[model samples]
Target chain A: MEFTNALSIATPELIVVIGAMVLLLVGAYGGDKARPAISLLSGLVLIGAAVASATGPLGQAFMGAFVNDSLAVFAKVAIYLASAVAILLGHGWMIRNNQARFEYPILILLAAAGMSMMASAGDLISLYVGIELQSLALYVLAAFNRDDAKGSEAGLKYFVLGALSSGLLLYGASLIYGFAGSMAFDDIAAAAAGAHGTSLIFGLVFLLCGLAFKISAAPFHMWTPDVYEGAPTPAVAFFAAAPKLAALVLIARTLGEGFHVIEDQWRQVILALAVLSFCVGAFGGLMQKNIQRLLAYSSIANMGYALLAIAAGTTVGVKAMLVFMVLYMVDVTGFFACLLALSRGGRPITQISDLAGLKQDRPGTAIVLTMLSLSVLGMPPFAGFWAKVYVFGAAIQGGLWIFAALGLAASVVAAFYYLRLIKLMWFDPSPGLTDPAPRDAQWVAYAAAAFSFPLVLFALGWLDGFAGTAARALGLG
Target chain B: MIAAIAFYVLAAVSVFAALRVVLASNPVHSVLWLITAFFSAAGLFVLMGAEFLAMLLVVVYVGAVAVLFLFVVMMLDVDFVKLREGFTRYMPFGAVVACILLVEMILISAAVAARGAGAHAPGVQHATDVTNVEAIGRVLYTDYVYIFQAAGLVLLVAMIGAIVLTLRHRPHVKRQDIHTQVTRDRKKALAMTRPETGAGVRPEDLV
Candidate 1:
């Protein structure tokens, strides 16, 4: 890996890194004066990086520690775009709450860069580095509102648990390296093919555990509710969207590419995780009064659906995973945008009751939220429905009928909560949350809402085709 | 035979210190025990022929991390009784978790051992002439360069996060407003005029 080659391959991350560092210095010196400019610049930098990442030629770099491929490009673009929108949605909230510090955007940029790295990671070392980079920034972002005790508590909890998971991940990587005699995915796959030793199986289990924790799969999703409820709404929005996408991709890479030789073992583990996650996500969200926590549970359940495709252990399964992730990104981005608009008197409207009669107050916003919720429920004609179709289709195609059936049941259970939210908006009497939606939130809300629709027309051919192409590029097919 | 004896001594000391780190009642003693554990672990690393790792363990763990732990233990006013109170209440669950972890470790080690001796070595290949640090440098700089930079970014985020959490400006506190003072002009900030020496400062001038 020559210097220039590495630079070219890592242009997206480098752009974000350089931009974040410069803005960090500028923010430090400029103080309160340069906050808005820095934030705007942060969004632009993300967009620029997204463009850079999308245009780059596909190849491996840094002795195969870093890869530039269609899969990486797709994941990076989703992360960068979702993060950029998240920044925009969060900007108004940060300003309103006096939490618009320069560090907020810089940390977001760093996290996005880390996500990009995760998308492109080719080896265990790179994977660990990417996960840590993203987690560290997220730990800060989770507690960005330091004045709030809940925020501090969320940050601390996330940090401790996150650190533990990272330790587990690193230990697993080390174990795998020991067994395989290499850290590269190719060599690990070769080693795994040769023999299925107990150590190798244990290492794979630990690795899956760590990845499951990252994606908030059940049994490891303890932190999701508290962190979501405690963190700023905008940060939570970003949290619910981008990190899950990146983590899912990394799981695909690690398991599908690296540990594919032991597909039987890993597939069972993934199926069990997916089952638990679906049940937990569905049942957990039912009693949630806090809307954020409710969304948190929904996220867990959604991740379960996403994991189903990967559990199929086929190229089409990977393709379905990509499709599911892209649709999820759209739905979550819209959902959070609507959430941002639901605030009143500079304080976020966190309670489900706070959204009472939202339809009368802000009909357009309410309708958009209803649509996003419907999509999330996997109702027909929405992106979320198609996302589910592809994943369940892949599962059935791979003969995982039990998993697919359980997933369908979970979707029905989860739909109740989504419908309840919509019902509260349209039928429930007014609680006087008449404050207008924040500036710039409407655009994001509309864009996300628009994407959530038109799925039926495009998903089967275009989106599936695109995801299939990317999955093939990774040698999945 | 001497080398084997040294390795056994280091390993036993490390294991003992590690147990003491958890069992010791006093927080200060626990920190000290942790340092001992770290030192003996470094010795074990050195015995394994990874001198670079040994140096790092000593420098990073013993030198910096343990000292920081000691300072924190001494600085905080901790309620040892309260800390131990939950021990009995949570003992069953904690013990179950601990037992599970122990079992998992035993299983992993047993499996590794079953795989035979070659599995114990590090994966990276190196020239015999190269030093441990040099070999590490080669791999880290070439193969792991991006990861190294990512680690640096992680540290940067941690630094900024700490500062963000602790730094605050109270509104009521009287602090120098450098910008206001520096921007002030003589005409706006001061009234200068000729006056009789005996007149001193007038009330209007003071106002």
Candidate 2:
């Protein structure tokens, strides 16, 4: 019975792993012709994994190393969905540029599997393993365009910094394990709940720092702009969407599950990171010419807003965090889709100036960019507005009025960059005649952007209920 | 008494070698010092009764990781002098950071030692008759199997990542497709018609 229970709990990850392996074998021998089929297969595999995870019973497996619960289900489904969209959109772009390789989808599948593991991780060992698994694939994906020196440099920088952060996290984990005498989240929480210790607090600090780096929050966010600017556009899109969700969920889980007792300590640290991220994200992008770098800063700031909910340390905070992640991912994927669609004379455009007079041609892409930009700016009736509402409202309920105020001010400042991009797309004259949407995959991305409109406007109640249910299931409520 | 003496000797050598690993001007020498440090650390592990970990340290770190370090250092043509040019400039800042870390570690360890009862839970008691390896194997294969498999996945991803990052496609290289070559028919290669006797097959006739 126990064996079957474990198998059932792990079915989703197993399906993804098996699918990836099969695709790897098929892709290896099938040559370049297999890319499209494999890409489609990988997408289906992720959807299947999501379904499996959602249908599973809520409980723990692997001696409490992996948790199968509403929270895990929600996070895994979101990750798989976002990753599937990335693969669907990225395939056509890669193929059009003669950069299509079977490895792209395989890596995505592996990365998704890692993220699903992270979503369900019930212990620190699982967390570290999941994180490393995800990051290793991401580092390769970031440097996918090896011919580009900047891409290689980005990969190297990400790898080195990521490894350093991983080391710090391990150190912190060891400290906690030493203090608590167990690596399990429940044990650590119990140990802390029994009596607070300085060692446990230090461990939590280091752990939070490591997670902050993962999410590219403030002082630890030095690598975000350069990496985003240099990595291939699809990889950047993936980076901005799914991995951020996974990392954010992991943070919520680590703090909520393992260190909830020390909320007084960790909340302050999170608050500092949140404030700094908001400031840097707001002020950093004002002078940026590169579109990717601008978005990177925007993402940093967005992370700050999400961290506000985390700082609240309440059930409402957890629910708001979930809703915000889903909405933010939608906006990120849509924005990247527009960027991916932009090309003139077969050369990819990376500059904010490149969008100048884009409204004249490729009006579909221009409009999509407009909506996503508005959404990112937290304009009312857009999805980002509600995402912000939940987070800010939760903060206020938790007596974190100062953070909410800081967030509101930061949003106003951050609006300028998002609006500037829109203005460039609409008002400014084209530096050269703009090109039409160049790839079939971009239409899929446009469809994604289109879907977000209804999602933001009509799906608000569903998102709220789902997030609330998941949070309640996790006992945060 | 003998174990204490052995532990002290290993600890001293390990610390010295670790210092040399950082301070050595040549990368190759640094790698060599790193190997020494790893070996002494393994020795210390043995002195602490973790035989499996000690053996693993020697096998994995000394055997594979140290060799990898040596390979990397040998492969790169680094200018040792240029690399060290910033040493003096950063020394004070580095020293300050080091001192802070040292203080933090000392404080943490001191506190942990003082509150020793809180450091170990009574729940993880093990049978004394079991060897370390046997005990580890039992738990790892049972309770930790999933995590162990996850570690394997990390390694697999690492391998794939390394290959994808370094492997380059040589566009100019032409390779034969054996399947196509073998499937080629005799009819496609040769004309079946009989040629006119004695006259050289005209180009049209050949076709």
Candidate 3:
């Protein structure tokens, strides 16, 4: 009976894992000939996981090591769906390049399963397991094109650095468990809320260091640009979307649920990270030529905003983070999708200047790419603008006006690069005609672009209410 | 007490062996030094009354891990000297990293020193009658069953990831067809050809 309840609560993750195993069997038997079917089935499985997450038996189970509350459900749905889009995007690119192996979709499916586990993680053990599962798959995806030297380097660097960070995280977890005598967040909270020790603070700081590395916050973000620049384009798109949200949600849970009493201590560390991330992301992006590297910097800056919102440590703050992340996830994925769709003379576009003649060649892709850029830069009439507004409002409400001002300044500097991209796309002389866009990538780009602008207005009311309910799930006023 | 003296001698040798493991110029020497360090660490664990953990340390780290390191060092023809040539070029960056680590260490020490006697655990006690292994098993089976499974999944992912990254199937390679092999019967296998007792079957007759 106990096992049944736990499995019932973990149904969404189980669905994804079981579906992936079944797909793996099919792929293994049918070989490379079954890749396309496997990819489509994987996407459907992710959508199924999202649906299950949405319609759920919301409760905590597994000895309170997993929670299926509003917050986890909301984050899990976004993660699963974004990863589904990633699978669709990868399928098209893989076929075009003849790297369409069946393992690709299954790896993605498993990674998505791991990310959902991160969303629902209620204890440190689940948290570490979830992170490792996702990361091990991603390390392979980074080097998916094993023949490419840059891809292999990216994979090795990511794996080595990621292992170090995991070590740091585990060390902190051990310290916390040693001090508190439990791995469950509630027990940590119960012990920490009363007679806290500085060791607990130290553990929290180390834990934050590891979590900050996950979001690619400044001072721990050395690997982001290289990994992004070197990984396959579709895989880069996947990296830019779901993993950031999963990491941020994990950070919020660890801080909000487990260490809220010491918010004063953790907030300072978060703010420092936020401030450094803002400056570094803005200035570093200005010098990047590779579009993937530029987006890496952009993600770093966006994480700074998410950190600022989290530093507020309020219900409104968590709500702001949710809004920003979901919106940003869509925009970034679309932007990369646009990159995936367009090519010049059969060569994939990797450089910013490669987009110069895109307007004349593919007007639809050019237009939508511009919309995504505007949305990410927080221009009016786009989804990202409201995301920024909510973030800043939360900051100001939490007496972080100075930080909000810093975010604005960073946004202004960030706009310079976005405009440079636009100027090149629209004004520069034609390089040459691009290859025709693939159906799947073209559609995903269009849908995401549409979501970033007109559709977002409709989504805003529902998303805000949804985000509010999720914020309330943490039991913070 | 002799227990105190044993602890000091073990600790000193462990630290020295660890330093040698890093500073050894030869890869083979490094592996040997690493094994020594592991042995000393296991000895230290023994002195601390964690005999089970000490046995595990020797069995896992010394017997398995150190031997694996030795195999990798001997089998791979990595140019260690060439690799170290860039160490000087990266000296400044390395120094900065070292300084940052130093600061972190100091700060942590300060935090602990400032909070001296107040740092006590909430207290996790095992029954005095049960061994430590049994105590661990009780929690692992009851409260941590989900975590144990999740860890298994993590290992599974790691295995899958390694295989995916390394495994490649070359196209056009001829392979066995199991279905064809298994479904063959006596009717398909034998033509019931009778040859003369001293004569060999011709190629056409075999076909």
Candidate 4:
């Protein structure tokens, strides 16, 4: 590919890279004093990249190894937006803890760039590279506080489990190459359609296992709680929202597009995974005292819902999944925003008990948290509710009523934990510990909470058009 | 042909050293074995025409990861003396397993050799010009693109996990507060007291 064409094709990533480098230079020169300004600049650059990706021409590039399709464009936009929000939420926490450093924004930008690459990755090799870039940046971010033992332990567990998953994925990729004589998704689809082999199927199974780990899908999701609990709150927020969305999209792109021909083999595997994820997500959150761990379990269940839409393997299913993911990201971001706001002294307030009587102390944030928590549980008049409905509707259309029923049951189980959080915030007595409000955190709380109201109100009207466009873009119909 | 033979020999050495990395009793020995394994792997890569990866493996993995292992083992208070105590008991079973693995490898090699050279060779068109590095680059940038991308993501995740695992927060430890330390004034932190030498007070106490 010509350099200009490559630049044009990779503009989103290029923007982030340039921005990160400039921030790093500025940070080094300005020392600790320049971190806030650099972080804000990085956030703007991320927003710009998201906008550029949305407006950019959509197609394949680099010999079809990277694709710039509507689905990729939309997913990149979501990833960038989430990254921006994460940076905003993290700014206050970093400053308060005196851990605000140049590497923070740079790593965030690099991770965002990686996620963007992952979203558009058209071939397995590109996909692997994108994921590693994202993962490496995140690893640093997770353990950025070198003095914290818990943070270090979280990073270690995540590394070991992540390495094992990577090994599984690489072995699967080699097997796929061996069986299909090609690693491009398009080529694999064509090869697998005509050929029959056990190796190919086994490779697919292993590949799914790796992707499952990424999205924190059940059975492959052992590392989620420990990692979430161990990392700093903002890092956990970024983990819970952005990477999971990218992984889900990549999973859909691979299975829904590339392996559509062998749906019979993968369908059962996905169905089993979906059921397992749902049960685990619901039941796992119940016993969690730490809010971050609770959210981790919630993420698992949410992924199950997203997988349900994917399991349909229809165009409607793809659109529904996309809509669901977008809404879920917003809802989860809002929830984290509230958690980030609930600080005592200079430290972030964590643990379920820490949120007691938040309704009295921080009424606005508590209200937003309640709405967001309700949305997460699939309550009506919220974006998550509509997202779930579309997913269930897709499932029913595909005649997977049993899965839909399981989803409803899981939603109920999810509600129990979310409601417990709400009760703690409202019904419980106030701890009466007061701390000065951090300006940046207050803004994040307002923004996250305010964003959800419109999401809830406009979800129904928004879905039909969004779903139609997504369907057409994906060639689902 | 010579290059191919060298590659095979290096590859065998690398595999043997890697096996030793896991089986060696002393952590220090395991690290040393790992360094040798990395060197042999690098040599094989060079023969296969991956000059960049060969250099990277030698410089980064051997120089950094293996050295880190050695340093960590040296610094740790592990009793190497006790580790050797159980080796004799496990020797017979280990030997039997090694023999079975060797037999399987020989059989696999014979099967591959029976298929002949041309069976596994590239097509006639551009075969001479298609160096191993070029072929790998082509496949990586094209056919195996997603897998390559995924590998990077895995590494990134592993890196993050490592940091999270090692971070420590000690609540009770007394550490220097730079802000407070830097802002201290001589007038506030230090006092010059003048005591009266009277009313039966000792001179030392007054001073």
Best by lDDT: 3
- Across B1-207, the per-residue lDDT of candidate 4 in tens digits comes to 898789788889988999999888888899999999999989987775567788889889988988998999999888877888778788899999989967964674455456442243222244457765676677776655445544554554455345444544577565899998899898757656565666554535532
Each candidate's TM vs. the true structure?
0.93, 0.93, 0.91, 0.81
For candidate 4, what is the DockQ?
0.21
lDDT of 2 by residue, A1-477 (tens): 997899888899999998998998898899788888999999999999988888877788999999988888899899998899889877888877777888998999999999988888899999999999999999999989888899998998999999989988888887788778888898889888864455698787778788788899998999999999999888899999888888888888888888888888888999999999988999999989999999999999999988999899988998999999899898888888878778887888988888899888767888888888888888877788888989999999999998899999999999999898888888999888655675654675576667568656667787788888877765664
Better of 2 and 3 by TM-score: 2
RMSD of 3: 5.2
Model 1 agreement with the true structure over B1-207: per-residue lDDT tens digits = 988999999999999999888878789999999999989888888887888899999999889998999999899999988888877888799889989999988876776677673444445554789899888888787777778888899899889888888888886566899999889887777776788888877746744
Q: Write the per-residue lDDT of candidate 4 for residues A66-92, one digit (tens) a residue.
A: 788877887888899999988988887
Shift in Å, residue A317, candidate 1: 0.9
lDDT of each: 0.87, 0.87, 0.88, 0.79
- Models sorted by DockQ, best on top: 3, 2, 1, 4
Q: Which tens-of-lDDT digit does each residue in A1-477 have in candidate 3?
A: 988988888888999999988998998799888888999899999999899989979998888999889999999999999989899999989888877788888889889988988999999989989998899889989989888899999989888989888888998898788767789898888767765545677778778888888789998999999999989899989998899899998988888899888888888999999989988999999999999999999999999999999999999999999999999999999999998998877778999988896788788998999999999999999989999999999999999999999999999999999999989989999778888888889998999999998999999999999999998888765
Q: Given candidate 3, what's the lDDT at residue A413?
A: 100
Q: Is 1 or 3 the stronger prediction by TM-score? A: 1
| Two-chain DockQ for each candidate model | 0.46, 0.47, 0.48, 0.21
Over the true interface residues, superposed, what is the Cα RMSD of model 4? 6.7
TM-score of 3: 0.91
Candidate 2 C-alpha lDDT tens digits along B30-93: 9999999999998898876678999999899999999998998899999878998999999899
For model 1, name the residue pairs that clash. none
Task: Give chain A TM for each model in order.
Answer: 0.97, 0.98, 0.99, 0.96
